[model samples]
Target: MSEVEVVVAHRERATLRVGDVFLKIDADPGRTDIEVEAMTLAPVPTPEVLWHRPPVLALAALPGTALGRLGEPSTASPAAWAAAGAAVRTLHDAPLPPWPGQSLDEVAARVDAECEWLVSNGVLPTDLVTRNRQIAEAALRPWTPVFTHGDLQITHIFVDGDEVTGVLDWSEAGRGDAHFDLATLTLGHEERLGDLLAGYRADVDLDVIRGWWSLRSLVVVRWLVTHGFDPFAPGCEVDVLKSRL
Candidate 1:
């Protein structure tokens, strides 16, 4: 019998892997629905949906290892990172999905609230939060919305050698800023940005990408803490924030 591996578990959702199949348990069925629809619409490679039963959605595992993880150096070749970037660009170029993404105002409000919490609670130094908040402002400007894989974390991307095998986690997919996806993929791995941009083959504002790095790191710290994750770990979120200095 294949052993069941707990991939990730939190109050909102849990994913389990048994043999080659992954089972996703989400508190909101709507998220799963969106994931399914997004995968179907995405032009890039995505996991094959084995089945869906309410809260439990089963998916066939992709063939390759993750592109990389946050706080860790990626062993993937530059070509592989570029391939991942190419895949992202393809997704962005695809037709927009039916659902909309969070508005700029909404994002700003969240950043403000999170910064306050980080400072008031002494989670992060006030100066650090303040500077990052200032930097985050750059990302708040108007942008052309594209189809985005809203949570384009490094671990969600898979690569085999120099080719992108597949991308995972589509629940958060929607129409959003293209730079947001770029920032998310390159977070904690700034050195790879150039390689990625080469594959992306589009002009982008570096400041906005940096701003997103700050904005995303700040907003996620609280959630990580509440969810029993350690953002303060070496080379993790805190380190990413400190790099902004």
Candidate 2:
């Protein structure tokens, strides 16, 4: 195997190339378990940066790296999306570990920590509390907890043709509301998003999915703040976030 290429790089996490092996280095002490656990939604092989005294994640590198893939939709919709939706749903429905020992408040607090980090990093707007409160009141309701792709989106749905080869970046997976995953796909591009959500709702509720959408927008805004408003990648999503926010 050849050394994997460091295709995507970030301030806190740096992807490495080590013979078809991608290692993610979390160079910051502010990392948390809530973030890294998000990657399990996909069945692909991933390695983590042991963030004790030194934290890092070593991910298995996938074949083929598209330099300009994010600029446009790589796969066509309908069939491609359908396949992707199924792949995610399968993960969402998988038998997950019970949370009998944990409290809901603890889980919510974890999310709050990430949200706070995002805000302080300039990845999220200063009005996070107000925005989150509104979303919580409107969208958070009775939900059968399942595996959520915390950051599911077209960008994260990696594919090899009509087949969803894999879902990338599981740094935010957990037994939470499934709407977050559905909203990540639908909220912005309602027409196309609706189709995707429709595909997802084959297993869950679409009406109560708005909270996830709002939360997804919050995440997108954070991406925009941390990353410059790139017209191609996050730019498209940001535009949708602005309209909805």
Candidate 3:
């Protein structure tokens, strides 16, 4: 029998791997529903669903290794990074998902609330929070919606050699801003942005991407802390924010 490996386990969800199959257990079935549908709709590669039972969704693991993880240097070549970008473009070009995503007001409200919490709780220095909030404003404007992987963390993308093999964790996928996906993918790995844009082949505002980098970092710090994650780790979210100064 294959030994079970704990992939990720938090309060709301957990994933276990047994041989080549992964088992995702979420407290909310709605997230699993979205994940299943999103994988069905995405134009780019996604994990194959082996089976799904309520809170537990089983998947066949993709063949390749993850592109990289936050706070860690990527061993993937420039071509591989570019390939991931091209795959993201393809996903963005796909037809929009039926469900609506978070609106501009909703995002702005969250940013406001999170910033206040950060300052009040002393999670971050007031000056750092203030500067990042100012930067985050650049991303508050309206945008054309596209099929987006809402959480396009490098760990979610898999590449084999110079080719993108598949993407994972579709629970956050929906119709959203294209730059959000781009920003999420390149969050800590700013050096690779040019190579990514080379394959993305689209006009993108660097400032807005930077804005999202700040906004995303500010908003997620509290959650990361509560969930037993280390956002303050070296080259992670805090460092990503500090780089803007």
Query: lDDT: which candidate is best?
Result: 1
Stretches > 4 Å off in candidate 3: none
What order do you get sorting by TM-score, best first?
1, 3, 2
Judging by lDDT, tell me the better candidate of 2 and 3.
3
1-245: candidate 1 lDDT, tens digit per residue: 99999999999999999999999999999999999999999999999999999899999999999999998999999999889989999999999999999999999999999999999999999999999999999999989999999999999999988999999999999999999999999999999999999899999999999999999999999999999899999889999899878
Instruction: At residue 179, give the lDDT of candidate 3.
Output: 95
lDDT of 1 at 64: 90
Error of 2 at 145 (Å): 0.9
lDDT of 1: 0.95
Sorted by lDDT (best first), the order is: 1, 3, 2
> What's the true lDDT of residue 74 in model 2?
43
How far off is residue 100 in model 3, in Å? 0.8
Clashing pairs in 1: none
* lDDT computed for candidate 2: 0.54
Cα misplacement distance, residue 59 of candidate 3 (Å): 0.3
Cα-based TM-score, every candidate:
0.99, 0.64, 0.99
Off by over 4 Å in 2: 1-5, 28-54, 63-74, 98-136, 197-204, 219-237
What local lDDT score does residue 143 receive in model 3, on the 0 to 100 scale? 97
